[model samples]
Target: MNTINSILFIIFFLGIIGTIINRIHLLSLLLCLELLLVSLFINITIWSNSYDTLISLNYSIILLTFSACEASAGLTLLVSLSRTHKTDLLIKLNLLQT
Candidate 1:
C-alpha cells in the first residue's frame, strides 16, 4: 500500500510539473491533464479497494466518465485552435486579434 501511494504521488506531481512547464503548447497541457486524471483514478481505485465498498467504486466510475468527457472537449478545442492559428501555442491564441 505504501509503495502504491508513493508511485501515485510521483505520478501526480509529474503531471503537475508537466502541465506547468508545457503551458505554451495546448496539446501538451491536455496530455498532462489526462495524466493527472489517470493518477486520480488509480488512487481512487486503491482507496475503494481498501474500504471494500461498492459506493466508492461507483464514484470512481463517475469520475472516469467526467474525465472522458473533458478529454474529448479538450481535444476538440485543440483541433479547432490549431486549424485557426496553424499552431498549438497558447501565445498565438488571440480572440481579439484579426
Candidate 2:
C-alpha cells in the first residue's frame, strides 16, 4: 500500500512537470491536468482507507467536484481559443498582446 502510494505520488509529480515542460498542444495540457487530478483522487482514497476515516473521503468528493469544474472551464477556454485562432497549439497564442 505504501509502495502504491509512493508510485502515485511520483506519477502525479511527473505529470505536473510534464504539463509544465511540454507545450505541444492545449488538449495535451488539459489531459495532463486531468491526470494530476486523478492521481490526487487515488492518493486521497488510499490514505482515507488506510486511516479508516470519512473526513478524507469528504475531501476527495470535494476534490472531484473541483476537478469537474476545472475540466469544464479548460474545455470552454480551449473551444473559444480554437475558434478564434483556428489552432490548439500553445505556440500560436499571442499572450503578450492579449
Candidate 3:
C-alpha cells in the first residue's frame, strides 16, 4: 500500500511537470490535469484506508465531484474554442491586446 501511494505521488508529480512542459495542445493539458486529479483521489483513498477513517473518504468524494465538473467545463471550453478558432493549439490562442 505504501508503495502504491508512493507511485501515485510520483505520477502526480510527473503530471505536473508534463503540464508545465507541454504548451502545445489543449487536450494534452486537460489530460494532464485529469491525471493529477486522479492521483490525488488515489492518494486520498489510500490514506483513508490506512487510517480507517471516513473523513478522508468524504474529502475524496468531494474531490471526485469537483474533478468531474472541472473536466466537463474544460471540455466545453475546448469545444467552443475549437469551433471559433478551428484549432486547439495553445500558441494560437492569443487574446491579449498587443
Candidate 4:
C-alpha cells in the first residue's frame, strides 16, 4: 500500500511540475492550478483513509473552497485582460506597458 501511495504521489508531483513549466497558454496555467488542487485533494483523502480520521476530509473541503475562490478571481482578471487586449496569450499582455 505504501508503494502504491508513493507512486500516486510521484505522478501528482510531476503534474505540479508540468503546470509550473507550462507558460505558453493562460488556460494551461488554470489547468495546472486545478491539477495541483487535485493532488492536494488526493493526498489528504489517502492520509485520512489510512488513519481512519475525518480531519483530512474537512481540510480537503476547505482547501477546495479556497481553490474555487482563487480560480474565480484569476478568471475574472484574465477576462478583463482579454477584453482590453483581445488576446489570452501571456506574451501579448505586455500592452500594459510594464
Instruction: Score residue 28 of candidate 3 by CA lDDT.
Output: 94
Tens digits of per-residue lDDT for model 1, 1-94: 5999999999999999999999999889999999999999999999999979889999889989999999999999999998987999998788
| TM-scores of the models, in the order given | 0.93, 0.90, 0.94, 0.81
Give the per-residue lDDT of model 2 (tens digit) for 1-98: 56898899899998899899878799899989998999999899988998899999999999999999999999999999999999999998997895
Q: Which stretches of candidate 4 lie over 4 Å from their true place?
A: 1-4, 95-98
Model 1: runs farther than 4 Å from truth?
96-98
Clashing pairs in 2: none
Encode model 4's per-residue lDDT on 6-88: one tens digit a residue: 87778778778877788877877887887778778778888899899998899989988988988898899789978887888
Better of 1 and 4 by lDDT: 1
Worst 10 residues of 1 by lDDT: 89-98
lDDT minimum window of 10 residues, candidate 4: 89-98
Q: Rank the candidates by lDDT, best first.
A: 3, 1, 2, 4
* lDDT value for model 2: 0.92
The lowest-lDDT stretch of 10 consecutive residues in candidate 2 is: 1-10
Which candidate comes out best when scored by lDDT?
3
The lowest-lDDT stretch of 10 consecutive residues in candidate 3 is 89-98
